[model samples]
Target: MEAGKHDRGRSGASIPGRFVAEAGLTVPRTVLIVSPYFPPSNLACVHRARHLANHLPAAGWTPIILCVDDRFYEQDPDPLLGSLVSPELEIVRVPALHARMTRRFGIGDLSLRAWSALSSRAADLLSARRIDAVLITGSPFYPMLMSRWIEPKFGVPVVLDFQDPWVSAWGADQKPLSKAGLSHQLALRLEGPALRKARFVTSVSTRQNEELAARHSWLDASRMAALPIGGDPGDLDLLRAMPDIRRSRLDPAMINLSYVGTALPRSHGLFRVLFKGLAEMRARQPGLAARLRLHFIGTSNQANDSETFSILPLAEAEGVADLVAEIPRRLAYAEALGLMARSHGLLLVGSDEAHYTASKIYPALLTKRPYLSLFHRLSSAHALLAAAGGGIHFSFTDANGLAGLPQDIAAGLERLALDPASLGQPRQDHLEPFSARAIAGSYAAIFDGLR
Candidate 1:
């Protein structure tokens, strides 16, 4: 149970030793990873690259990260995140056009602003080194375009990793001339060219891979990898070691349940369902509900936008406003974990999209506290949480399966408020499959096949 040792004998543990070439020379293959939002910038997408780079060496790939300098990020940087990065990794930071300079023009994506500098720097490294592959992870989907550009000139295979679906059906209901509609159209125009020369495409779930395959007839199952960004035990270990970081937000004396991360647009229905359950709990078990406090932290997508709150309004609508507390502004990476660690339990609400995967579940599982997870029945997250055991999981379909959702949520909240110990800990054997090291091994397999 050492810090950073989540996979001592678990499945998908890294293979020990260096890779050998046909000439019997022992050396790890090099991969240049294009990650525009890297550490110190506490955006969730950074963990995908951070964890991959931290563990890829054991899987026989040396990663050189190409990222935007932290100075350009509009969000306040987290120094703690910088400490979590592997000291051995090589990180190259290039200049990007600051948001201040581009906000007037309505161009805010860091990848778009950093495109020229990143591409030029990448070309220099490719020409100078023996790089075996290029992996561009996105949400700043614009950088994936480098795949189409890089492979042709450098003769290196490229992998485009998506933290989310590039072209989504989420905004289909918006007006044609609206911002969401315009963005969707632009994604439709760009995705094809970005993927035009990629040797392989990767996403967080199999459902997402299927979406990609369906969108592009040329993309087959064999050309894709579904790799979830599972939790890093090292994060918990680091949180435990940092004495300065404290859970000042919640009271230990009160029965508190925390929900962290941004609440998506499609998750509003789920929130209403959860709030209704709270209202039901208040009616049926007022005394128990009085002791329970439901917290929603970082519910807004914009980190510093305290004015934009998503969960509280719904809680007010359900008449459970007294029971619910929301902090729309984002917390630093470690501080968020500290709040979770001190809480009596965790709460996870899923999107209506079945393909949506909640990456936060991995870390919550590591916390060993009781969690109430409400997800679409077909979501990859629901399946993962159910298989691991311990948590209270309620799955619903978009249509008829939701009739009983409020009662289920009410019952789950009662157990969490009264007899939390009955929920037990997630089985270690079951949890190992979603560990960060295991995820890195999966990525290594896909990289090996491409080369």
Candidate 2:
């Protein structure tokens, strides 16, 4: 029922009823959204973020976003995506120094100038504003920690969006800043205490949530929500029905197994194993290499940055020659999904060492295309695909004690080659919940509650 109706109550004409109705409609709480990446910066960073800020007011809370200006990020800002934000809410953009610092230093690590300036700016912003609540996105977790500095100054409730498993995210062979460890002490100094004081904590997935919950017991599980990274409906609309590249005459009879997203240096060895397996395919079926298109969607630091910047040479040495094509980030997603639908199969790689989840796995589901995943056997991707009954997976580490890495990939490819026809059909039931609007509504609900 609509509020503020002229209802007949026991007290005739219901004057008090009108007053009660007026009292029921409370003013929307102004929420401050702290994020480093907002689109059309087009960084694959925040799928959940845009949804939250754009949908929040619809759910009742007023979103006041404080983020790095898109122009500051070394990329063109999409006015179209920015238009999604309601003019009713305030969006505060501060030009950041990180991107420039990254261009100078070759990586997006903390710069003393950038770090000090932002930390100070964040403190100043908090001090000047009256925010009912603050939702901080981690990455530049530094900005989130600003809440700690200003929380005492202004008693505002804060939410820490630790979107990924931090601290534990040290790359393999990247020695801990310290062992016994002053660096461990210092690194934790940045993330620890601020998160400890947070009113609530959230991560993108249940696995990430468990990792956080294991450390901070005060994080209410009820408050925890799996904010699955989402694809734009516009992105999804790009999903097109195309003939299997392996089946089509234009592509020729070749197995096109595509992997979208970065094949980081640490993870390159895993793909190397697959490449080695392809070598086997080459040895047995000589023409397989010509037909085999192992498309790597998204830029590599090697391609995008360059460095000790190894992996490509190593991949070539292993014999997956001319196989690795590093496509630009812009064409990776929706186009890749369509490619997945038409390719013989999609290959998913995750860390077998850690209980990691690949964000690319979800988009593959939308394709109705079968994916062959290699990583931890019990991964969520494997489970989701198994439930949908359209994907296959095995642990590369477990099968051959990591010995048959490439050979295993080759063997798996051969197996997939056996049945080029996949049970390709959209899992509409599964896709329904993941629709951008649905996810956006849940975000709206979270924002509504904040009000």
Candidate 3:
């Protein structure tokens, strides 16, 4: 078969004219997407890969996903996510090294364990087919390292997608540990070669792109693109089908504000600042304070291991423990959206790190519920929320900004509680660039250029 043209099977159905036009030819270019987390894993990492795989077909590219087998995941699987995978798309699953073995050896993660298998499968696929390019998304940054192995063997261009920084500097909230610093140095040393070999790189924020470029002088600035994470339209449809669960859980008499998703280690300081601001607001206006409740869903202070990190201690220190409610376990994507839909307002919390953009921002904006965000002045989310313009933005790092945060949050809550409709709808035009379809197109452009 010719490149970009796959066999249509026994029926031999003719290729659609629109697909040919969109592709700028009769055949669609093939790009392999390597992600350690995909459908049924219910991981935040899966959404971007899922969105890319779902929309790339229309953009004149065929996505063949290579993901970890389901048996490797520790989290409960969400079968509904599998529905998003199109029948035409091909998925290849690689067996993962047993979690027990990985834990016992203290060697990286499941991605590291399955590296050999992944490398072998990816090589075989490339050797047998016409793969235009390879795109690898990271968190299990291990899979990205495979580019060094695959690129040299198959001679296919490689693109590295940074969902989060592979090596993050320890923040103020994080205790300075010698071991942690050493690990960061080791990861950077290992990551340097593969990154240098990549033809293109993409990150969720411009700050991250800048940081990576600054860290690696060999990296060409022209080859990097900032591609933000976006909400899946199908997820929105699922939310519409579910009844508003927020109303049932929230007290009608109280003004409810909610923050969804897990709290990262660097976010502890910001949460402390927010809870302190809330306490100050409560002291001045006891009536409003009495009627206010802050709900945290799918959040925990201690995310991994036996380490206990509960935000309740901070809430108690801020004297708002009674007003706080915590749900420590993560909910399914659809369930989280239902919680957002019923709440009067949404809360976005970001770390002091400039490159740290909350992945939840896009979905929260899509809910059209009024939102209040606290982020570092330098954070990409600060700029994004300001431009989006439907919500309040507070800079947590500045003393002046910090002083007014409580009042800002209070005013936002009052507005949402009294008249949510007054906050109006999110500017869908501003939201267009962050839509999954648009982001997929951006990736397609990169793939096409590389091809």
Model 2: per-residue lDDT, tens digit, 253-291? 556777767665446656666667777877887666666
Name the regions of candidate 2 deviating beyond 4 angstroms: 1-25, 57-62, 75-90, 98-131, 149-153, 169-173, 176-185, 217-223, 237-255, 299-303, 306-311, 326-344, 396-412, 415-420, 441-451
RMSD of each: 5.8, 9.0, 4.6
Best by TM-score: 1
Candidate 1, residues 1-451: lDDT per residue as tens digits? 1111111123333223346575766666888888999988999899889998888888888888889888788899988888898665677788888799888888898988888888888888899977888999998899888887788898999999999987887866667788778888899898988888999989999999998888888886888878888998888866765566365689767899999989998888888988998999889999988888999998885678888878888999999999999999988888888788888989988888989999888878878888999999989999988988788999998646765689888999999888889988888887787788998888888888886
**What would the TM-scores of all predictions be?**
0.94, 0.74, 0.89
* Candidate whose lDDT is highest: 1
True-structure RMSD for candidate 3: 4.6
Model 3, runs deviating above 4 Å: 1-27, 171-182, 240-249, 301-309, 396-404
As for candidate 2, its clashing pairs are 273-405, 273-406, 277-406, 277-410
Could you arrange the candidates by lDDT from highest to lowest? 1, 3, 2
User: Model 3 residue 237 lDDT?
Assistant: 76
Better structure of 2 and 3 per TM-score: 3
Local distance difference test scores for all models: 0.85, 0.58, 0.77
